[model samples]
Every structure is written in structure tokens, then in C-alpha cells.
Target: MSFISVNPESDFSIHNLPYGIFSTQANPKPRPGVAIGDYILDLSQVSKLFVGPLMRNEAEEVFNQTTLNKLMSLSYEAWHEARQTIQRLLSKHEGVLRDNSELRSTAFVLQRDATMHLPAQIGDYTDFFSSLEHAINGVKLFVDGDKALFPNWKYSPLGYHGRASSIVVSGSPIRRPNGQMRPIDDRPPVFGPCKLMDFEIEMAFFIGNTPNKNGDIVPIDEAHKHIFGMVLMNDWSARDIQKWEWIPLGPFLSKNLGTTISPWVVTMEALEPFKVVNVVQEPKPFPYLYHADNYNFNVNIAAAIKPDNGEASVVARTNLSHLYWTMKQMLAHHTITGCNLNAGDLMATGTISGPTPDSYGSMLELSWNGTKPLTLSDGSERKFLHDGDEVIFTAHSERDGCRVGFGECRGKLIPALAL
Candidate 1:
């Protein structure tokens, strides 16, 4: 139990001390912090207490860094030990931090007064289409119904390199991009505001530990040690632009506009209690991608939409367990070709739609390529997002009356700038 009283339903309980970067008005520089109830434990002010054997040497540097990359580059043993130290310090039963009044005042800051920043300085980003249902639903709309799944899809994880420069922390505005799209068959392409803007509900994991060399391939069994934690993600899309440019090469302007991620990174250790059986893979993946134990977590993800000055309407609900390719498999496949991965690199699970229509993760699938319109609770309809529409994505795992969650990934769509 923590010395601080936390609501039973709050995501920042003693069991879930997720980390982030924040800056208060009084202290304008971003620093490392841990979430506890309604307050933020400023690691910058309490770095001295991390005197455990694993972190005594580097506590100050790790906690004082503006971004999490420095801490993430440390050894896995260090990461594990740091979490243990933090848990003990916050424990109500016994600990120096819980009993010391002066230290507590300096280390704890109210959440409302702090501005959250991107937890890590992402060097690169990759988006993976790991959900089987999402692929099938999307393929059926763009390709022949009988040939939904591509032949190469089941063999390996499919992904594309994405723009790291466009990733923004939650609460940032996503300006609708102006791009080229053909309105009719045999018509000239016109450049204007994106007409088919959409939001993709997804989850992304951060890389920790030292990076591999250009030729080193990380095995599947050792992949978990390299993963630091997860955050909710919303990959904004322009459907019309994607259709025109995705013939020989993959996404370009259609996806590079913007992507949003939650500030806090919920550690994998905190979500261990919610682990569920992995989805059954057909034809059995190659030996390199196989893992005997289940790697799937039963995290419930949902999306909501709020129009200009209107009440929020729940749009979709899905789960991470619905993913066909496990995270370990994706990591192993990523390096099999001798590619290197660096600390703070992000890998995302592209739109995680489940088996049912109501569980679809994007408007393109929920509305069936604009053939139908999604009806909201307030007697409103939407086939594609409009300017001033805010999309919010949230995720959590509940077990034994404890809920650990990635707070929220939210962004509002603003009008595109004039050409």
C-alpha cells in the first residue's frame, strides 16, 4: 500500500508506478517523474534515495535527464532494480520517503500544475499490422473479398518505417494535412484538405537497453528484455491519399502528417498480471518467431469522439489479445535482416480491430469505406473525421480489483493551412 491514498479505480496506484517526463510552471525544465495517485513523484528531487546496488552509481544521471533515453540505455538489471526501489519508497508500511516530511514536499508535485512531455526522444518509428481481424476487414474493402489476406502476411509480420519527426505527445492538435487525391475515375489529381481523415486506435512499445549493432540479430527469447513499456497511440490517416500512392511503395504523405502517443509509459512488469493466452497462429510461424509461453496481455482499448462543443460518444472497443503476431515475433523479425534498433525506438501495433463490427478500430472499417455512417448517441453521424473533432484512445488491464492503465492518447483535428 502507498502512503498516499489512491482511488481503487485510479490507474496510478502503488502497483503501477508508470514513468513520464513533465515540467511544472515553477520548474520549466522537463525531468523524469513517476505517477502516484494524483501527484507526480519528481525523480529529479529524490534521485539520492535510489541508493540500491543497481542504481547507486547512475541515479542522478538517469533521473535528471530531460528524456527517458539515457535511463532506457541502461542494463535490464538496473531497470528492474529501480522499479523495486521506487515501490519500496512509496510503500506505507515502511520506507524513508514515506516517513520523511521534508523530502516528500520537495519530491511530490500536483499533477494538475505540471505539463506532460514526450517521455522519450524517439529516434525511429515503425508501424506493424499485427491484428488479423484488422487486416481482413481492411483488405476486404480495398481488395477482392475472397483474397483478403495476402500470401506473405501469415508468414511474417508486415510493417513500414514511419516518420519519427511527426510524433507528438497527447493533447497536441493534429492539423488536417493537404494532399493529392483523385475524386473520380480518369480525373486529374487535386491537392487540397484531406477529405477522408481517420483515427487509428493502436498501442506502441518503447525500446530500452543498449542498441544492437548493424549486423546483430536479437533472438525471440531475449526480446522481452529489450522492451521497456507501452503507450496508447493514435495514428492519423488520410484514406484518399493512401489509395492513390500505395501501389509500388508504401505510405508517404498519407501517414507522415501526425501520430499521437500518451505521455506515461506503463512498464511490462506492471501488466504481467493481465497476461492471457496468445492467439493461435495458423500454419505455425517459423522457428525464429516461436515462443512457448503466452506473451499476450488482456488490455482493453477503447476510442471516443467528441465533436465541436459536444458530448463524447464511445466509438469502438477492442483488446490486445486479438493480435495474431506476438510482440516478440515482431521484434525478432525486425532484426532478422541485420537491421539495428536503438533505445527510444517505437514499434506500434497498427489498428487493433477485433472480431465484431462494433469492435472495429478505425472509421474506414466501421463505416465500410463510407458505404454507411456511424451513428453517435447525440443523434450525430460520421463517416470520416471533420475539423475540430477530437479522438481519444485509452487502455487498461483489470485483474484482482487493480487497474493499470495508459492514461489517454487524445488529439483534436484542426483545419489544414492554406496553400
Candidate 2:
């Protein structure tokens, strides 16, 4: 619908104006931008055109920033206004931008010439075990059916605090972590490079601009207002290290090595059309965690692995709807104890796996704890990732011929440092 041509299959269509921070060699300063077809609408160049009352005065300042934190810290109304203004400016009938040849040249940059950066300066991060199939798979691999489903899991969304310092934008290189692990049951633990490096395919959301008071709880109905948007994520893991250290505590160094996320943050407004019925929750949740509306999305998620010299092969496919705990429920439970949340905080749905082997989200589950090896397109077999292996995650939702997507969340594994 825009003056510019957009391919029907392109992830960034007229329907999806995802936001991110980007830079180019000509203008090395990172600034906010929106993805559109094969080009990026440099928000900094078009900031003055945001004439809406809510964004008219503030657009220039926020769009010129190096990170999205300031913009994300705005109210829900402001976010909506900004999106509406952008959509209008890009409309085919909007002569302001479509007819301005000089403005168009400076405002649009080819995507290939721009470098993407983290959308926001994340202050905190949490990863939740929200997928029923993934949880069951873990139980089957490590423990017996007697402890098939942990009793506390059904009551609330269980999660662990994660390190935010190591979180990286997509395309970063992840060096294998070195840690202690008990390789043999009868032998003492040894410290060295990880033997079971894996990737957890996940989808994460950024908290909106408002911050909750330390003693206040976020009601389930209001959780959506506190969420800004979603992105694809790869929570790289060193399974051997995690198994040895996650006894009394959960995920330490094994999880902190590196986490990668897609650059573009697909807004909730763009995904509204893809909303589907929430998964049935037996033993109805407490009032604080219950919501009548559907928060589950039908986003299709998939992960693939590519060797340095080989073609990529998809190893797993799943849907965000597989999550047992909805994002709203997770947020409501997160603040039930009065824990404060700030703008740009991140929360992720952990390992979204479906009920079949092909739908598993992690290498750990896909290979059944390394007992089964997966053969790649080049006939190379992998029980776990090798030094040159690259993990790529993609997610999208489509309905009525419109598609909204999170571009590739990718990372390559490199050799660990020598002790």
C-alpha cells in the first residue's frame, strides 16, 4: 500500500513496521529506524513528520537516540500514536513523504547497508519454563515418570533470573564456555570447555515504559499495557555445566555465556490479528493469574543449524501457542510479590516445544540428551553443536494474507579460551 514496492513474501511488509536501532557507514551513529521491505525508514530523518499531539514534540529527541530505552519508556497511548503516525506517513496517499524526493533519499536506506543493534538497553531479564512439552521432555530425559510434572509448575509460572550483561544482538559470535562438569558418575568433576553446547529457541517481550512500584502488583488485565513488543531469542546453553551446577540453584555460568536476539521488535499491534485461544489450563489458576482474553499467539517458530561450509537444515519447528503460561500470566505472577519492573526489562518463554519430536525447541530435546544424533543436509551428524556451528531462529505470524515477523536471531559457536 505504500509508494515503495514491497515483495509479497518479504518479512517486512506494509503491515509490519517493526522498530530497531540501526547504523550505516555514512552515518555511524546508531539511531532508531523501522524496517520496510528491503529498506529501513531512518526515523531520525523523518522525526519532524510525526505531527501527532502525543509524538510531535518528542519524536525528534527519542528517534535520535542510540538505543530504544527512551522511546520504550513512553505510555501505551504514545506507542500507539507513534505507530499510527508512521503507518500514515508510509501510506500511498500520504504525499508528505511519497512526493518528497529529497526527503525519501535521506530517509530510506537499504537494509543490507545498515547494521542492526540491540533494540533497547535491557536492565533485567527472566526466562520462564512455560512450555509443557519441553518440561515433560526434560523430565523424561533426566528423571523418571514419578516426577513427571513438578507440582509447583502447574500453580504458577516458574522462571530464573538471567544475566543481562551478556545478552547480544543477532549475528554475534558465542565462544564456548568453560566450566566444571561431572562427566562420569563415579569420577570427580573436571573443569574444561563445554561438551554439550546447545541453543534454546525462545520468544521474548520487552516491558513497556512504565515501571511498577516495589510494593505494587500488576493486574492480569493490565499486563498487556506494560508489554511493548516481542522478538526472537536464542538462549545458548552448556548442558553439561548446567546439569552439574543446577542442583541447589538454577542456571548460572552455563546460561550467561551469551544470549542472542533478533534486531527488529514486532509490535503487539501488528500481532493482534494473529491472536488465538489460550491453551486450556486445568485446575483454574488463582484470580490474580486468570484472564478471560486470549494472549496466546499463533506465531510459527523454527530453528536450524548450519555448519561453516554446509547448507542450513531446520531441526525443529514449533508454535508460541505451545506455551503453557501466557505472557500476561507470567507478568502478573512476576509482580505478585511486589518485585519492581522497569522499562526495557525482558521476559522470555523458555524452549517452546510442541508434543512431537520434530517440534522440540532445543538441541537437548531434539537429540534426546545426546542419545540420538541428528543428520544435517550435508550428511554431517550432530549430538551437540561443534565449534563452527551456527544456530538460527526465526518466527512469524500470518493471517488473512498479512504477515508479521521477527527476523533471524543467529549466533555462531567459536572455540573456548584455553585455561
Candidate 3:
């Protein structure tokens, strides 16, 4: 892996490289780009870079248009092939994109002139609660102590369907939602605005393809074959509204307001250099969910809040290694009953908090179920997000003197509609 000319400290710099869709204001047509220095090398314009067994005459077709939808539709092997090609083209080798002044203008553009779009045309989105620390803290609020953890937690991945339509690309505005929320002392539930809006710092996996059989679940050993990459996700919540309506079903209005995903989809191959072990589990998983080798990989994950008008405060920083279950286990368990997972489908690790207070991934945990108050820099106490507040989630891989990061997941809160 040759070193490319990139900023020493930029989040999108070489050590922190990733892929996404973007284009200038002059050309709104979305195209694939790999982050280098402060600019996005426009792959759509430099189509010749894609060649070889991936495609012969049509090798350049992947970059002909904007949005990774066409490329994302390819098989997992194609995804890896394309990633490797792009990585090489962006590498320190001077012949490709580096020293060629003639191709520089056509190949590179300042990132500021462009807007980042959703990297994939998501087919489906599923969220899994796989963090042991986050689960324990949350469960303790309701159950408390070792009893806080459910007996079956170590056996399977807990998951639920999420709204794909509401999953926004980074930098979009998120409006507060009108829903039912009841004060702890209220007589009954009140039909009004949400007071406890929240941000869930999480990491989600991108599925590249499905199993051979339709409706068949991905097996544990082969789950990585279907995985494309990873991104930071914020499953925004309306905690007060959730409290009132979460009776029989898990989440409805509270969890659906607006979810944000990082623009870059850092490929799994890019993360291979930093794979770490998964969190330790007291009771080993059942046969179907167990893997002989690695159960999960390590990626340093984190979340921070930059008030709409203030400086950034690192509210939480944790690791993907804290996950109780491996992505393979989750995918295998998800499909053991015969559910299908398609290419571009998303699976998330819910609220990836560590064992300490600084790593509390969500306001619900930080505020301790609304009983305690979170003090901010400006002397403001937050039980939940106030209008105009912003939340951001970021992830990266840094070790052995290298770094790779997901840009950011940012959204501002707007006043709830009067409806």
C-alpha cells in the first residue's frame, strides 16, 4: 500500500480514506469519489480507471453516471474488485492520479464545491441491538443489576425493521416530530410535541448481496461474503413519545423521526488492516451463531454534539469491538428462520456505548432515563435535544500509524410541526 499525497490531519486524509457519492454544483449528477486531501477525485469523469475482469468493454460504465446504485447492484466479488481498483488509483503511485497534471483537472475537485449524497440506494434497513454495555445500561433502568441483562441476550441478536425512506445522507436537516408523550406525573398520554429527542450513536453494515436461495438467511461462516462496508448511523429518537406508545411493539413514532448515515461507505477491505476481536460474552452463543475464528472486527467509533451555535464536545467515544455479537452471527441468526437480505440492505449495531459514563451513546442513558440532567458547556442542562441542537456520529480505524474515518453524521433539530 503506497502512501498518497493527503493532508496530515484531515479526517478524509489517506489514513482515513473512504468512498461516497458526490459532484460539483456545476454538475449535479451524482458520481463515485474517493476522499484524498481536501478534494474528492471524481471517478465518474475518470472512467478508464476501472478495468480488468470486473468488466471488459463496459469496465468504465460504473463511473458513467452518478450514485453507486449500478455498482452496488453487482455481486460481492465485483464490489471488492472495484474497491481494490479505486484504492490503487488513489494510492501514492504517481502514475495514476498523483503526478499527471494533464488529468488532474478532470480527476480532482475541491470537496467544498460538492455535496455528498447517500452512498447506496438502500433496499432495506434493519437495526440490531448488539452492544452489551449499551443493553445492560438500558435494561438496568427498567430491570437493574445482572437482572438487567436478559438470559437469551447471549444467544441471539435482537433486531427490528427500520424506515429506509427516512435514512438521510449526512448534512440533512431533521425536523422535530409531533407525537404522543406523557410526563411521568401526567394523568394519561398527551398528544403534543416530543420533549426528549435523542441521538443513537451506532455503526451499520452494508450488505452487498444475498444468499444463493431466495429468502434464505446468510450462514455464519459466509456472512462476510455478503457484506460490503460500514458507516456511522444515528437512529434519532423521541424518547418521551417512545415512552407513551411503546406498549406491545418496540418502537414506532419515536424511532422514525429521521436517521442519518455517514456519506462515505468505508469498505470492509479497507478495514481489514485493523480488524480486532469482538467483546467477550460470558455465556457462549448457540451453535448457529458461533464462529470458530473471529466473531467481530474492531473499529474505533464515537459520537459528539456540536450545539447549533457552539463548539464540539465529545460526548461519547467507544469501539465497534464492544459489540456483543459478530455481524456474521447477527446475519446468520436473522436468516436462520428464512428471512432474506438483499444487496444494499443495512444492518446496524444499536447504541454502541462502552461500560463507562463517557461512553453512554444516547441521551437516554446519559440522562439516566430523564431522572438526571446532562450539563453542557454553556451551563445548559439537556434531558433531550432542544430545537436547533445538532448531533454528529463518526467512526474510524487508526493503528500502526494509519487512519481511516467515516466523515460525519450531522443533523439539526427543527421545531415540531403544529399538526
Candidate 4:
């Protein structure tokens, strides 16, 4: 236990020291940090204390960097070593930090006074359609008749390369996209602000330091070692634009507008307690995507919407365990074709919707293609997000008095720029 008091339910307990980047008033430069209780423990200040065998070689330079990419480039054994060292320093009986008033004052920053930044310098981002429920719901709404799942849907994880440049930290305002959309009868597309603004509740994992040659495949059995951690994500969507341009390729301007993610990256080491049996794959997956062991997580994710002047109302509740394709399968499939992934590269599980309606992970699904309207606590009904509406996402996995959480993925819709 840490000397500092942490609420039993607090997301940043000593058991879960998620990594992030933060800047305090005293030092405005963003540097690596770890959340504990309600304080941000500046990893830069404690860099010298990382004398463990696994971290000794890299610790000196890892924390001084502005982004976490350098740290992320370290091996899993190194990451585990760093976590173990941190836990010991913060433990109740440890005199390393708690006993030293000057060191403690210089190292810990109050969470409220700190500003968080993107934890990694994401080079490439990929989004995968992994949830069976979400995929089925999307097909039901978009496909014309009895046809729902595509023939290849059951065989492998389907994914698309996304724009990494548009990914932003939580709290960044999302500008409503301006694009071309057609009318009810498929008239000529008109260019203007998007009418069908929506958010997809997702969870993304950061890649680790495993070096794979450009032409080498990352084996299914070894994918976990290449995965660093997970974070909550909101993949903002312009449904109308997606509908119009998705015939040939896939999502274009409809998705690249803005994607928000929580600051902290909850390491797989911290999430091991919440592991669950992965959703069963039907029709048997291809040999390339097959993994015998379960890679599913049991994180509880909840999302809410708040109008400009209204109270926030919970919109959806879901779990990552609902995904039909495990993240390891996605990673394995990604590299099966010899596509190399670098450290800090992001991979997202697209819209994790559960079996029930309340477990829907996106407004597009919850509103059912605008046929259903969701009522907020402010007596406002919404089919899709309006300007000034804020969407918030949060997640945690708890068992036996231990809880690990990704703080919040929040973004407000700002009106499109005058065009």
C-alpha cells in the first residue's frame, strides 16, 4: 500500500500506476508521469531511482523525453521492471519518497493542477471491426435486406489504416466536419457542415518495442509481447460522409476529422486481473488469426452525453470482452501480411457493442440510423450530436478490491468553421 491515501475505488491506486504525460504550473514542459491517488508522480524527477536490472540501461533517458515513444520502445521486461520499482518507492513502508520532504515536493504534482498531453507520438493508427454485436448492428442499419455479415467477416479481423495526425488528447474540442452529403433520394451531394455527427466508443492499444522486420510476421502466440497498453478512445464519425464515400474503399473524410483518447495508458500488466475468456469465434477462424488462449479484457466502459446547458446523461454501457476478435488476433492478422508496426503505433477495437441495446457503443447504433431518439436528462432528445454537445468515455476493471482505470476520453463538438 502507498503511504498516500487512495480511495478504495480510485482509478489511480498503487496497484494501477498507468503511464501518461503531464505538465504542471511549476514546469510547463510535458514529461512522463504516472497517476497515483489524486497526484501525478513525475517520472522525470524519479528517473535516477530506477536502478533495477531491467530499467537501469534506459531509465536515465526515458523520462526526460517529451513523449512516451522512447519509453514505449523498451521491452516488456523493462516496462515490468519499471512498474515494480515505482510501486516499491510509493509503498507505505518505503522511505525513498515519503520520508524525503524536498524530494516529495519536487516530484508529486496535484492532478487538478496538471495538464495532460498525448502519451505517445503515434506514427500510424489502425482501426479494427472486432465486435460481432457492433458489426451486426451496423450491417442491419446500413445493408438493404437479409444480407448482414459479409462472407469474410467470420474468417478474420477486418481493419483499415487510419490517419494518426488527427488523433488528439481528451478535452480537445472536436470541430464538426464539413463534407459532401446527399439528400433523402440520393440527389447530387452538397458540400457543407456534416449533419450526422457521431462518436464511436472504442479502446485502443499502443504497440511496444518488439522489432519485427518489414517483411516478417508477428506470430499469433507472440502478439501480446508487442502490445504495450490500452486507452479509451472516441473515433468521431460523420455518418453521412461515410455513407456517401464508403462504396469504393472505406472511411475517408468521415473519420479523419478528430479522434480523442484518454491520457493514461493502462499497461497489460495492470489489466491481467481482469482477463476473461474471449468471445467464441464461429465458423472457425483462419489459421493465421487463430489463438488458443483467451486475450479478452473485462473492462467496463461507459459513455455519456451533455448538452450545452444540460446535465450529463449516461448513454451506453459496454464491455471490451464483447468483442468477437481478440486484440491479439487483430495484431497477428495485421502482421500476417508483413505490415510492420512500430513502437507507439496505435491499434483500435472499433465500437465495442454488447448484445443489448443499452450496451450499444455509438450514437449511430443507439439512435438506430436516426429512427430512435435518445432523451437526455435536460429534456432534450438527440438523434445525433449537436454543436456544443460533449461526449465522455471512461473505463475500469475491478475485482477483489483492485481497480484499474483509464481516466476520461472527453470531447465537445464545436460548430464547423464558416464556409
Q: Top model by lDDT, which number?
A: 2
Supply the TM-score for candidate 4: 0.98
lDDT of 2 by residue, 1-419 (tens): 88779987788987889999999999999999999999999999999988999899899999999998888889899999999998899999889999999999999999999999999999999999999998888887756656768888888999999999999999999999999998886999999999999999999999986769899989999999988999999999999999889888888999999999999999898899999999999889999999999999999998999999888999999999999999999999999999999989999999899999999999999999888999999999999999999999988888878988888999999999999
lDDT to native, each model: 0.91, 0.93, 0.78, 0.92
- How well does model 4 score by local distance difference test? 0.92
Instruction: Output the worst ten-in-a-row residue range by lDDT, candidate 3.
Output: 1-10
lDDT of 3 by residue, 191-267 (tens): 88888888998888887654545657677888888777788999998887887776678888888878899898877
Q: Which stretches of candidate 2 lie above 4 Å from their native place? A: none
lDDT of 2 at 234: 95
Better of 3 and 4 by lDDT: 4
59-135, model 4: which lDDT tens digit per residue? 88999999999988898889899999999999999999999999999999999999999999999999999888888
Lowest lDDT 10-mer window, candidate 2?
A: 139-148
Whole-model alpha-carbon lDDT for candidate 3: 0.78
Worst 10 residues of 4 by lDDT: 139-148
Whole-structure CA lDDT of model 2: 0.93
TM-scores for every predicted model? 0.98, 0.99, 0.93, 0.98
What stretches of model 3 exceed 4 Å from their correct place? 1-4, 142-147, 210-212
